[model samples]
Target chain A: MAELVTPAERRRLFTLLSPAYLWLLVAVFLPLSAMLFFSFLTDMPQDAPDWGVTLGNYAEFLTNPTYSTLLAKSLKLAVTVTFFCVLIGYPCALVLAKSIKGRSREALFLMVILPFWSNSLVRIFSWAIVLRGNGVLERAINFVLPFDVRLNLMFTTDAVVIGLVHSYLPYVILTLYLALQAVDDDLIDAARSMGASKLTILRRILLPLSLPGLLAGAVLVFVPVVGSFMEPRILGGRMGTYYGTVIEDQFVAVYNWPLGAALSFILLAVVIVILAAASPVLKRAQT
Target chain B: MSRVDVANVTKKFGQAVALDDVSITFEDGGFFALLGPSGSGKTTLLRTIAGFYFPEAGTIRIGEQNVETVPVEKRDIGMMFQNYALFPNMSVADNVGFGLRVRKTPAAEEKRRIAEALELVQLGAMANRKPSQLSGGQRQRVALARAIVTNPRVLLLDEPLSALDKTLRVDMQIELKRIQREIGITTIFVTHDQEEALTLSDRIGILKAGRIVQAGPPREVYDRPIDAFAAGFLGEANWLPEAALSGLSLPGSPGGRRFATRPEMLSISAEAPGEGRNAVKGRLQQRVFAGAMATCLVDVAGQQWKLVARDRDIPELPGGGEVWLSWDPADTLAVPA
Candidate 1:
């Protein structure tokens, strides 16, 4: 196989790949490398001539409980959002992939992924309008109940969860739908013919078979939700101060580039550990 | 073992009728094959009997109980699909034990039954392997083992051996028959392969366009097809032209009736056959050699007639010349034109 490629062909292959790798170096790795360098500095080298290299940012994170608390809160929020997405998205995916057929399935699948077409901020703001005090949701519920009710859902953790779930639900549905669609309908028929009930079929066949996709979807949702800031800020108001928002504040509000880079680097480390833990299942899903 | 009686079953898909008031009975502990071309309702009939589809109007009885409305899981039937459909996530033992576990069979009994089923299919050593780790034939055996482990009242096979290679299919056919006989279970299988149907089934039901064209023992149906469709679908048929039937005495009035003879029953020769044999004169078009058997294509009165004979039985003949195709009068089949 190695002898199959001539010298000119090898050069052409390298030439084709160099542009993308060069772009990655300039756009992604270069910025990440600069951030990593800044994370260990005592001050920004741009403005301070007396700036010295230090592990102060890292030491601060270990010494202060507030950063850890906010990180833990962000992690909890990620878990909550992912759990709801799976709970709601899996059945929707199942119906789209299996129960519905022909043109309607295509139309419904388009609807499932339609959220991705709109801007994330627009979707988050739309949820804010729906879930606010005396919003559309409360008004509709009050009208149906034949009694007036005051339901204020805005500026809370629940609002943040709702907005984030709305924004990321499509990821879960798309991955799960692909996985469920790959499962042969004949397996279901075979199981049923063997005297297996619906729940047993789900537990023994469908769930185990689609576990890789489910985990893949969960990881997709969890990783993004942990680093989320916009949804919580727009919907949670004063209550929305997660680790991500603090990282945002450091760069934009406090002008503390070193601390923000350090925090960002720590978050990257956490995400890497998670991906490593999930590599086995994700690798199985690939094959 | 139970006898399955499907009476006046009618299934429709939108405006299209998949099963047009079909009715057939599968005798207890007997092997039956539903044979048909694609879109001929053979599979629809099998799925309907398996409780996957409920006919608009029908009475399906299994062991004296009406079960047309019963859902598939409660029907107590075992089905093997064409592609095997073994759970890839499960080990062979787990795949075989699924039915028993579903029924909440005791742990000891489930293990013993899984072992027994695997042993019956000659896949005992494959118990620990995942389905992906097994070969095609081994996976097929695992599927068979999984299907029969629960000892369901009836076994339904939806072209189960069609995915296998030719030689493997023949071997599986014999193995399947042996297992069915050993268990004394009523089995109904669907296949478009007439040879497989004839080789395995005690009874064969030929379906055409949502109707049962003929249903009888393999030999009976093969020898006496009810119509042109059944006659042509089941095996190769050499139609007897009007000129060829000059003195042939056919059953009933000959008008509006066509007669055909099986390829194997017809003999080819350079000279005319002796007395009591019906013979046709035709120009030899082509002789196709296929190892032990050979096919002679004869153009008789501008109509093609095929005669299958042993390779060595065919005598040396000049290329592209006249020949006599002869058959016994009893071998002639008469059907509606």
Candidate 2:
């Protein structure tokens, strides 16, 4: 009776899942659990034996207007960056999918993806070079324009958006490209032959078929841009008074690990809400 | 009454010439077919006429207007692609109504035309269903409906029935002929299947390597081929070597030379016929009984000849037995090497 209790059936299931379960426990679940636990604890400065459960850290971040403002700024930046990425990405994807001819199309596609292959730090530093005071781009623009204007190209909200768009444009292009390429070209030709003009074909057939790619690309751009710390910190410079700095200050400089952990959890919750909002659009597009 | 005249149409993609300087004329309401193998430029020719592809040098006249520079949508010609090309997102009624809608016909008139087109294709019940939900043949009918909805002057079909199964293809061939007759529009069908071309076309144009090699009625092209290519392409023919015709006077051959014989035209017997003008004595090489008829292979003058005959009161020559192969002089066709 003991032997036949459940092991005979459950053993196979356990074997089937043991590796993935172990990985989740060791890599993902354990770290999240530690963060959750640490968020509620208070520790003494440079001393032992001060661990206690408390809501003070959560209260300080939630109640503080500065932290709340930083959070809102991050979201606004993410939305703006995602919008630009999608607008630019869709036409690039369409060109890759439909317009460019044969081998040149493949070469152009490779050029679009080439920037992403470089290390992110190098890419960020290159932006730093171009956006700094009197960089090459600034010099070139000044030479072309009428007046000698040191255009404030870097360390602004616009600079942050530019960096974000540069960083995530590849993702948008790749996802939208996949979606656009999957469209049955015959459908487009059919519309044209049936007397639908080129504009009508795009409006009726091409756009709808590529909706899933647009949704996926939007989510991919938005989610990461929301949580990004480097580009805004590097490009925004002093004006980069965003949520990442606040969270970093709490975690690294202020010695308030719990508060920083709490802030991270709040950011995670925002991401969840975003994903929830985006999922329905994706599902609707699929059918 | 709209007649189509294509003069000196040529298209080239890079260095590869897709369509040579080919000219063809279609009378108003003529059911013509462009028959050829793959890469023979039939589709390119059709697309050029439809104005999708502008030729390197040519003029395409529909009625009396030269439409070489006109865009595809502005040309007002209907085209049915091989895969039917029905919009997956649109319902059958919407698909059929697309042309009328494009022309900006009123909603009531569009609805009436849509209904009539669908009725013509016998797809009235399937009006509300999307193209993906329909069968292969049904989708083709919807494409037909869509093409004919606006009453275009010329209808172009690019191997429209090639995607269907063999039986459905035959059924659709009959249906296509019937529809073309009823519509009385200048219809140009492109297909590689010779039988389908013969069945559906009022006139057939055989293309080879971007040029029309022969153009005539299907019967004339089949019964009286111009050269070796047409003879081999139209149907089965036993091509005899030139050296085999020692005593027959063949066309274009200065001396008595070679000719080709269709298997169905040649008669076989154990004893030689008394009044045989084109007769050769040989031994039976192989015999294959195909239910109603038997196909016999006879080796004559260092060449093998096939004879197909009905099962009648004829002596059956055993394989390897002596036999005589003969055909009527009228059945022999002179072919160039």
Candidate 3:
């Protein structure tokens, strides 16, 4: 057997832990440092190192009502999309957990995941192809019914919301179904034997037990909804102007990088505070 | 106020028949046991009575109502599961109050009943705690409390004590019997343990292959088994070839296939000279001195049979020495093979 090492020999063991240490520093800390530095540095007339700090970018975002309104609008849209996702996902997950059996359930689960396998841009474009003005959806409606109603649904706030919800619903359903599956069948039977109605059992037992996954799915669906860009870019041709559009303009079109970074920081802080406040309620919902 | 009657009930799961056509009557307020090995349909029968499964054929009547069409929640039955399925999230008070709440009882009455039920199971002090914080036996007590809180007409127990250790199981058995007698609820207990069934039941229904083999009082069923399977399953019995007991003209052996003898009924003597006592010549093959009795295995007429006798009544005999074995006419039970 080998002898145990002293402090001096143990110094050699620290070398084995370096790969993960170096990876975290390079991947996370370095990029974050560049973002912070860029936010502070000024692009001056002579392109010199001004090294001067200013609150101009922060003031511009805070005082300008358009940016603030866009932020509020983004929050509202994210909430609406998240609410619909939960409403639709819960029943879908419940049915998946309770009713389906064997290969049929597997096939159904795979079908729910199929949309996510294609590229996001292509999928969004497919919806645009159908819902665009005088497109297949409008044509089919006109062909079947006598009413002359033309739908130009491609680039609007409603379109963007629909796209976001469609993109994120599979995740919500999958997470909720996994949680619902963990509930004990014996609990349901016990409740039934206690003279509880089916509705009462669902309200008192099934819904409460599956709440953790519901909250987790809501968070997963909501956080990205507030920060989404592609859906708004593709579908919100003019009518939709979420906070992501402004963030994208600052970083991509306007080249005013500091303002965009400040807006991003504000969004991050708001999301953290809101989710933390919701954690207690979500935790209580489960079990 | 009336007994439960199950008449020619059969349940089929696809091609596998879970229960054959079986009929049995449970006396009003009677403590009956459905005893069998696994997959023998004891649990299924209990569940059917609880209205969990509808029989494919036949009628089940509780009191005077035909419960075949009644749903589980409307069946007016209380049930305890094998796993003691207490609601893990709710406090003991809430769990016990659930049935009363469902029946729309007044809050004051519900609270009083919950307290009384908890005290019945000796869990009055732990009403504020969750089931996850309790021990297996304590959780079981809570389950029992929850089931009895509503004063249901019939109580169903599905192997309720199978999860406990030996000491706890015995203690719970006594407690459960006391509770049943005090409440006087028509109770149907399901278990695979023959001793447990015998110890707790007023009448036992022994089942095999989804059919009832014998249904009677514990003593009668054990003393007068109808077949070989019944005699062997109820307890330990020594089986002898039909010819061995036929030669001696045992009372029940006119057309009987075999004779079954309990170990305690066989007796040993000092020597091998006997004829009027229906003695067989044999040598002592082995002897075991149990605390209260000594069990001896003797080879009689080239066949081995076990005999038990009180330590004081044990005859002085040497191992490998020839001896005479005899038993009374009433002790031998004859059964078809």
TM-score of each: 0.96, 0.90, 0.88
Say which prediction, candidate 2 or candidate 3, comes out ahead on DockQ.
Answer: 3
Q: Where does candidate 1 chain A have its weakest 10-residue lDDT segment?
A: A1-10
CAPRI-style quality class for the chain A–B interface of candidate 1 = medium
Off by over 4 Å in 3: A1-26, A43-55, A136-146, A149-151, B242-249, B254-256, B263-327
- DockQ of candidates 1 onward, in order? 0.79, 0.56, 0.60
Query: Which pairs of residues collide in model 3?
Result: none
| C-alpha lDDT (0 to 100) for residue A126 of candidate 2 | 91
Q: Candidate 3 lDDT, tens digit per residue, B1-337?
A: 4589999999988898888998999999999999988999988899898898999999999999999878888998889999998877689899999899999999999999999999999999999998988998999999999999998889999999999999999999999999998889999999999999999999999999899999999999999998888898887677765446545747553563777688788788866535545555678999899899899998866778788889788878899998877777677778887
TM-score of 3: 0.88
Candidate 2 lDDT tens digits, A18-130: 99999999999999988887788786434547678888878877788888888899999989998999889988999899887699998988888987898987888898888
**How should the candidates be ordered by lDDT, best one leading?**
1, 3, 2
The candidate scoring highest on lDDT is 1
Candidate 2 Cα errors over 4 Å, as ranges: A1-25, A43-48, A55-61, B247-258, B274-277, B280-317, B320-322
**Candidate numbers, best TM-score first, in rank order:** 1, 2, 3
What RMSD does each model have against the real structure? 1.9, 4.0, 4.3
**Residues A171-247 of candidate 1: C-alpha lDDT, one tens digit per residue:** 99999999999999999999899888888888888888888889989999999899899988899899999999999
Question: Which stretches of model 1 miss by more than 4 angstroms?
Answer: A1-13, A278-287
> What ranking of all candidate models by DockQ puts the best one first?
1, 3, 2
